[model samples]
Every structure is written in C-alpha cells, then in structure tokens.
Target: MVLTDTHTHQYYETDPVKKAELMQRCLDNGISRLFLPNVDSTSISQVMDMVDTYPDNCFPMLGLHPCDVKANWKQELETIYAAIKETKVYAIGEIGIDLYWDQTFLAEQQQAFRQQIGWAKAAKLPINIHCRNAFDEVYAILKDEHNQELRGIFHCFSGTLEQARQIIDLNFMLGIGGVVTYKNAGLDKVVEHIGLNSIVLETDSPYLTPVPYRGKPNESSYLIHVAQKIADLHQTTLETVARITTENSKIIFGI
Candidate 1:
C-alpha cells in the first residue's frame, strides 16, 4: 500500500533529526511519495533542499501562493519564474485566488493567478491550486483557461459537491486533505459521492491536521488518517484508497 501525499509542506521541518523521524514515520506507514509546494520566493530553497535530500521520495513544485501576492508580487513571481529554469518542477502552484486572509490585493491576486496559469500551460505541467474564499473567482479563471494542456489539482479542497463537479469537469482532480477527517467539515459528504478517480489525498501539513490529532501539529506521516477516513467513507479498504489515489496522482504529476 503506497500512499501519496499530493500536496504537503513537509519541508517546514528544518531540523535534520526531526525531519528524518517524520519521514521515517511516513515511509513506515507506506506514505513514501510526498509532493512539496513552495509558497513564495523565500520557500523555494527549503522545498528544493528537502527534495534534494530525499530525491526518490520527494518531488518539487514552485509557485507564488495567492496569499503571498503583495506590492512586490511581480518581483516575487520573477524570482520564482527565474528559479524554475534552475530546477525541474513537477507543477506550477499552490497558486490561485485567496480572499480569506485579506481582500486588499484582489486585483493583484487575479493577475498573478492568470500569469501563473500561462506559465503552467506553456510548460505543459499540472498546477497545484491554493484557493480560499475565492472559488468563484478562481473557477472563473480556470474555466477561461480550460484546454487540452490545462490540468492540475485543487489543493486543500473543502468545498461543495457542485464545486467538485465543476473542477472534475475541467479534467482536474480534487485534492482531499485532513479536512475530510473532521467530523463537521462536510467534506466527507462530498468525497462519498465523487468518483474516486477525481479525488487525491493530501495532508497540507503542518496544518489542517486530521482527527485523533486534529488539535496538534500535522505531518506527512499522518496521511494514513486522511486515507483511512476516505476509505471508511467509500466503504473500501485502506489499500484500495491508497492505490487509486496514488495512481490518480501519477496521472496528474506525470510521475
């Protein structure tokens, strides 16, 4: 049973000892393939370093997160884009519209989102979206960019079934995270109905930790909890869930 965490910030653990410990836990639990997303220019080194350390286990993605859009947003994108040539990135994301933190940079966020979408198309790579409180805004752009070469995962998805349908319609996959394990998150309802092919598992650690460990910090190793919950929702075994989702991840990341 090989579990794939399609979206995770596992690079946040900087300590060599702790990093190895968490990674061992993940591997011990059969969670070997972890795809890392860099938030902005600052996190590129960390994400790449972690991948460098565990090349066979970790994969890299570079993007300017929506929340990271600021007055110097253009400069940040330039830096991120320039670095793209320096490394082989699997995707161009966790980038999308985010109005959850602040609505102040809405326009900048939209422009940045569109710009990144262009990059994704040009490179023929999948995207890892970071949408929050801006589904309509994000979907509008996604719909406009829909094409044969346009594809990606909607990271940290905690939305309605209707939204899931809309996303899957565009040949994209829903990135189901720890939120699905939250008793009151309502994502389990969505997962229960959506086709397994349209879903992929994620932890978004060290945030959105699953139940039994909800109140504490999260790690990629806890991906089993998320997978177990989904298996329960789908009335299947953990191995089935892991296999289908990991295969779906391969379809998206092309690995």
Candidate 2:
C-alpha cells in the first residue's frame, strides 16, 4: 500500500537526526510520497532541504501563503517567482485568501492570490489553495481566473458538500488532511459523499494533526491514519484508498 501526502511541512524539522527518524517512520508506514509547499521566501530553503535530502520522496512547490501576505507581498512574489524558475516545482501553491486571521490585508491578499494564480497558469502548473474564512473571496478569484490552466488542490479543505462540488466543478482536487479524523469536524460527511477521484490525502504537518495525536504535532507518517479514516468513511479497504489516492496524486502532480 503506497500512500501520498499531497501537502506537508515536515521540512520544519531542521535537526538532522530527528529529520531522519521522521522520514524513517513515514517509510515504515508506507507513506512514500510527500509534497512540500513553501509558505514564503523564508521557507523556500527549508522546503528545498527536504527535497534535497529525499529527492525521490519529497516534491517541492513554491508560493507565498495568504497569511504571509504583508505590505511587502509584491517583493515576496518577486522572490518566490524567481525561485520557481530555479527549481523544478510540481505546483505553485499553499496560496489563497485567509481572512481568518486578519481582515486588514484582504485587498493585498486578493491581489497576491490573483498574481500567484497567474504564475501557476503561466507555468502550466497546478496551485495549492490555503483558504480559511475567505472561501467566497478565494472562490470569486478562482472564477474570474478559471480556465484550462486553472487547476490544483484546495489544501486543508473543510467545506460543505456544495462547496466541495463547486471545487470539483473547477477540475481541482480536494486536499483532505488530518481534520477529517476529528470527531466533529463534519468533514467526514462531505468525504463520505465526494468521490475518491476528486480527493487527495494530506497531513499539513507541524499542524492539523489527526486524532490519537490531535494534541501533538503532525507528520507524514500519520498519513495512514487519514487514509484509514477515508477508507472507513467510504466503506473501502486501506489498500484501495492508498492505491486510488496515490494514483490521484500522480495525475495531479504528473509524477
């Protein structure tokens, strides 16, 4: 059973010994594939470090997270877009409107989101959205920018069935993470209805840790738990979930 973590920040662990142990645990649990999305200019090195250490298992993506969108967002994009040219990135992502934190930067966030979407479209790559309380804002931009080149995952998706369908209609995959394992996250109901073909598993590690480890930090090794939760919700086997989701990852990332 080969499982894929479509989104993770396992690179945050800079301690070499602990990093190796973390990767070993992932390998032992059959989580062979992990996609790394760098949040901003500062995180590019950490993301690439993991990619360099595990070239075969870790894939890199470049983007400035919405929460990281400050007054210097233009300069941030200049650096991030330049980095995209230097590296072979699978996607331009972990980018979108995040109004959950501060509503002060809504305009800047929308502008940055549009510009990043343009980058993805121009690069012929997918995007990884990080929407929070600004789904409407994000969705609006997505609609305005919708086209053949507009595609990617809605990372850490925890929306309603209607919203899931709307995203599916856009030809993007829903990135399901550890939140689905929460007893009352209400994502299970949506997952139970959304077909597996439109879904991909993620851990978003160092955050959104699944149950049994909800209070602790998350890692890619815990991806199996998310996969298992989906299997249970869909009434399928773990192996089947692994196969289908990994295949979906390959189709999306083309790797």
Candidate 3:
C-alpha cells in the first residue's frame, strides 16, 4: 500500500546520513510520497534540497507559515514569491492565521494568508493550510477568496463538524493527521461525519506523533498507526484508508 504524507517536514534533518536513514524508514513503511511545506526564506533551501535529493519521493511547497509572519512578512513573501518561479512548487501552503502562539502579527498574518491564497490560485496549485486558534479568521479569508480555481487541504484539521462541512463546501479536503489518534482529540467523530472522500492523511511529522509513539519526535514511518486508527474509527480496513487517502492526496497535489 502506498501512503502519502500530504503534510510533513522531513527537511528538518540536515545530515545526509540521518536524512537518508529517515527517508528509508518512511519508504520501508510505504509512506513513499513526502510533501514538504515551506516555513519562510529560512526553510526553502532545506526543503528544496530534499526535493533535489529524492526528486520523485520528496516534493516542495512554497509559502510563509503563519507563525513565521512578522513585521518583515512582506519581504519574506516577496522572497517566497520569487522562488516559486524558479522551482517546481507542489503547493502554496502551510499558510494561515495562528493566534495560539502570538497575536501580535494577526493583521500581517491575515494579509499574508490572503496574498498566498491569490498566489495559489494564480499558479493553479493546491494549498496546504496550517490553522490554529483562528479558524474564524482563516474561514473568513477563505470565504472572501473562494473561487472555482481555489482548492487545497486544510492541513492538520482539528475543528468541529460545522467547520468540516464549511471546508468541504469550499471544495477543500481535510488533512487528518496523528491528532486523530489522540485519545481525546475527538477527530474520530469528525472523520466519521465527513466521510472519506473529503479526507486526506498527513503526519505533520517531527510533530503530532501517533499513539505508541506519542511525546516522541514524529516520523513519516509511524503513519501506519495513523491509518490504522482511522480505519478503526471508520470501521474499515487499513488498505481502504490508505487507498482512499492516497488518492485524495494525488488529486490535490495533481501528482
């Protein structure tokens, strides 16, 4: 079975030996397709370097993460916007509002989110959004920017049924990750309510590791536990979950 980690940050490893070892673990686990999201100017090189090293297995996404939004966001976006043209950007992503950490850059985050949405639409690329404690703000921007050409995954979605419906109504897929495996995350109910078609799987690795590995650094290789958890939640099989979610990832990334 082929599992696609629609949102993962495998580029965090700089050592060639460690990187290869980690990627081999993912490949052996059948988590073959790794889509890496960009955080800012600082992350592009690492992500792109991984993409270069594993051209087929690893892919790059270009965008300024919400938490990285600062007073110099305009400059960062400009730098990101320029780089998208020079490389093959799989998506415009990991972008959205984040009030959980700091609200000082709320306005700038909103502006950056909107601008990146425009970039995604113009480039005809899907987006992998990162939202936290600012769903209302993120939803508002999405509503305003809604269009036939606008589509992507709501990365690491941990919201209510109403929010899930609203996201699906926007023709976007919900990116289910290790959060679903948490004992009290309540994402199983959300998954059951949304059905499989509107869902995709992710690890958001180096974070949100699944049960049995919780509290440790997450790896794409541990994705099988996540798929198994979703299968248990849906009363389906791991193969079924893998097949469906992998197809959903292919559709969104156009791979």
Give lDDT tens digits, candidate 1, residues 146-235: 998899999998999999999999999999988998878799999999988998999999999998898999999999999999999989
| Pairs with steric clashes in candidate 2 | none
How good is model 3 by TM-score? 0.98
lDDT tens readout by residue for model 3, 1-255? 999999989789889999999999998988899899989998999999999999989988989999999989999999999999898888998899999989999999999999999899888999889999999999999999999989999999999999999999999999998989888989888888778889888889899999999999998888889889988988999999999999998989999
Comparing 1 with 3 on TM-score, the higher-scoring candidate is 1
Model 1 scores a C-alpha lDDT of: 0.94
Q: Candidate 3: lDDT of 27?
A: 88
| TM-score to native of every candidate shown | 0.99, 0.99, 0.98
lDDT of 3 at 164: 96
Question: Every model's Cα RMSD, please?
Answer: 0.6, 0.7, 0.8
Residue 121 in candidate 3 has what lDDT?
Answer: 86
Each candidate's clash count: 0, 0, 0
Over 1-255, each residue of candidate 2 has an lDDT whose tens digit, in order, gives 899999999999999999999999999999999999999999999999899999989999999999999999999999999999998999998899998879999999999999999898888899999999988998989988999878899999999999999999998999999999999889998999999999999999989999889999999999999999999999999999999999999988989
Which regions of candidate 2 are displaced past 4 Å? Answer: none
